[model samples]
Target: MDNKKVIIAGAGHGGLVAAAHLSANGFDVTVIERFAQGTLGYDWTDMFEKDCFDFCGIELPKNANYVKVPESVFVSPNKKTKIKTEVLSPITNVNMDRSAIYDSLIGFALEKGVKFEYETKIISPIVENNRVTGIFVEKNGKKETRKADLIIDAAGAFSPVRSLLPSNLMIENEFDNTQVFETFRAFYERDMTVTPPDTDWNVYFFHLDKPGISWYECREEYCDVLIGRFNKFGEQDIKQVIDDFKNEHPELTDKIIRGGQFAFIPVRRAVGKMVADGYAAVGDSAAMTVALIGSGIANSMIAGKMLADVVIENNGKTDVKTLWKYNVRYFKEINADICSLDKLREMLCTLGTDNLNFLLNKGVVKGEDITAAIKEGGIKLGIKDLIEKATKGISDIPLLLKVMKTLNEGEKLSKIALSIPEEYDENKVKMWLSEYNC
Candidate 1:
C-alpha cells in the first residue's frame, strides 16, 4: 500500500488517540490543535481510573494518584431506596491528571514519529473537483494549506467540521435538540478525614428531581459535577452549582483542592450518518455523548480505535460507498446501543423524579445488569432491552405492567430506527453526499 498522509484536526482526547493509533500503524499523521499546549488537554482525568489504562492499553506512573473505584451507588432524591452494585472489570473507574494523560499520549505519538502543530486552526476543508484534498490552516499570522489522503474530525462538542457541510446533513437522522448542560469537575488530594463512608472507591451517581441537574463523585479526591439548564448557562451558574453541592453534601465539602470550572456539552446523540465522501467524524464531534448521563471517554476511545481501523482498511479509497461501511458497522456495533440507551433514558426522564425514586427505593433495579445484559446479547435491544431490563427485577403486577408499557414505547422507537435500513436508498445516500445535505 502507498504511504498515507492522515490529518487529524483538534488535539482533544479523541484526536490525540486517533493520532497515536494511526501513527502506530505506520501512517504519516499530523495533529493540529487550535489551543495552546496547556489548554489542549481534557478536564476529566479523575473520573477515569484503571478502566482507561486497560481499555486504551496505556500504563501510568506508580505515583499516579488516580485509583480504580470498583463499586457504584445510584441515588434518587425523590425515591426512598438506593441502588448499588460492584462494577465489573474493563469498566473500572479511573482517576487521572488530565494534563498528564494528554501529555503522555501526545508524547507517545511523537515518539512514534507523529508530527504536530500547536495553535494551528483549521479554517476549512480544501475541496478540489468535489473531493477533499486537504485543509486550510492559520497559525502565527501565516495561512498555510496542507494536503492529505484522509482527515479525521475529532474536534469535541463544538466541531469545526460541522459547519463545512450542509445544515440539514445527517448521518441516520437529523440532529436532535435534546439540550446541553453546563458542568464542572474537580480533583483534590484524598483526605481520609473528610472522605465519605463506604469509600471502597465507588462512583456515586445522584439523580435529582430537576430535569437536567445531576452529579457524580468518586471518593478518590476527584469530583465531577454537572448542572443541566433548559437554556444556556455560563461560568457563574457553574460556580453556584458547585457551591450549592458542597453545602448540600457536607461530607465531601472539605476535601476541595486544585479544581476548575465547568464546561457545556450537548447531552444528545449524534446525527444520522457519520461519513461523507472524503471525511469522517469520531467522538463528541459526532455527538456521541450519552444522553442523561454524560460519559464519553470510553465511547470516544473505542470510536477512535474503530475509526482508525476503518480509515486504514479503506485508505486511498475515496468512494463514499466503500467508506460508508464505517457508518453501518459503527451504527450496528455501538451507535445502535446508544440509541437504545437514549430511548430508555428518555423514558426514565419523562417518568419524573418521583417515579424514578419510587422505582429505585421500592424495587430491585440494577443499572449494571441492564448494561451487562445488553453487552452480552442477553437483551436484544429496542423494545426488547427495555422489557428485559425492566422485568429483570420487577415482580409486582403493577410495576410489571408499567415496565411493559415502557417496553412498548421503546418498541415503537425501535421500529422507527430500524426503518432506516430499508429507507436507505441509493438516491438518498447519493443526494446526501453530492448536495452536502444530511
Candidate 2:
C-alpha cells in the first residue's frame, strides 16, 4: 500500500500501540495527545494480558517496571466466605509500570518515524462526503486541520470526536450517559515490619454495598489499594466506603508511591458500531474495556493492532465498510464472550446480600466462572455446571429464580453478541444492537 497519512487522536496505550503498528507498516503516522510531553499515563500500572503486546508486536523495554500477579483471593462482606481465583497465567495477565509501558511504546513509535503532537486535543472530525477527512485540533490555543487517510480515536470513553459525532452518525449509540464506575487506586508504602498476606492480591466482594468490591495488592515495598463501585450493583457513598476499607487495612501508609486518580471506568459493553467512513475507534473510545474487571489495557492494545491490520489490508481505504473488519475481528473473534458478561453484570449488580451469600456458600458462582469471564470474556455453563447447586438449593426458591434468570440472560446475550455482523450493514448492525439496547 502506498504511504497513507494516519492520524491517531489519542496517545493512550491503544493509540500508541496503533501508532507503533501503523508506522512500522509504512504508514505516515501522527499521534495527538492531550497531555503535556513526558507527562503521559496514569500513576499506577494496569494489569493486562500478555498476548496483547505480542499481538500488537510492541515489546517492552528490559527495565520496564512491572510484576506478575499469581492469584487473587475473594472474600465476602463479613469475611465468612472466601474464593481463591487464578487471575494470572502464562497465557495472559501481566502487570507492568504504567509510565514505563507508555514511554516504551512512545520510543518504539518514534523509532518507527511516528510524529508525536503532545498537548494537542482534538476538537472534532473534519467530515465531508459522509467521510472523515481529518481532524480539527487545538495546540497551544491555535486550531488547525490535519488531513489524513484514516483517523483512529483511541481517546478514552469521553472522546471529543466520539462525543461530537452527529446523532445520526452510524457509529454512535448509548456511549454517552452510560454508567461509569469512578475509582481511586493507590500504591502506598507498606510497613515492612508487618508481614504481607499470603496472597499477593486480595479482593473483598459485597463490601459497603451489594455491587461493589475492594482490592488490595502487594508489590514488594508498596501495596496497591483499589476501591471502586461495581456498576449497576448499588449506589453507595464511595468516600465513606474507601475510608472504611482504609480503616480496616492499617498497613497502607499515607506515603503513596503512585496513583490518586479519580478515574472513571466505562462499565458498558462495546458500542454496536466502532467504525465510520475514514474513521474508527479503539480502547475506551470503543468501549473495549472488559466487562467486570474494568481493565482496557489488553483489549485496547489488541484493538490498535486489529485496526492497523484492517487499514493495511484495505490498501489504506478509510471507508466504513473496509474499517468494519477491525470491529468484527476484535469483537466477534476476541471478545464476544466478554461482551456477554455485561448481562452477567446486570444480575450481579441487582442481587441482594442474602442472595450473594447464598450463591457463594452454595458454590453456585465458582472461581472457574470468574476466571473464564476474565480470560475468555464469558462463562460457558451446561446443565451439569449448575445441577449440583440447583439440587442443593431446591428449598430456596427465590435464590433459584435469580440464578436461573441470570443464566438465561447471560446465554441470550452471548448468543446475540457472537452473531454480530462481519460487515457494517446499517440494517443488520442496528437490528443486532437492539437486543442489548432495548
Candidate 2 — which pairs collide?
233-349, 337-377, 338-377
Candidate 1 lDDT tens digits, 1-438: 266888887875666676777788778889888888667554555454345445565555555555554455555565344456443343555655667777677776787778888889888777666556778889898899988877777776666565575533444322343445555555544434665544433222333344565554545544545455434556666555556555544455434465555565656545556666566777777766665455666667666766767666866564556656666655556555555455555555566565556565654345654554334312233455555656666445565456556555544444433334423356765553442221
User: Model 2 clash tally?
Assistant: 3
* Cand. 1 TM to true fold: 0.76
Name the candidate that leads on TM-score.
2
Candidate closest to the true structure, highest lDDT: 2
lDDT of each: 0.59, 0.75
- Candidate 2: segments with Cα more than 4 A from true spot: 173-179, 230-243, 246-250, 384-387, 436-438
Which segments of candidate 1 are over 4 A away from where they belong? Answer: 24-26, 47-64, 87-93, 127-130, 141-145, 167-179, 188-195, 198-208, 216-231, 234-248, 254-256, 364-425, 428-438
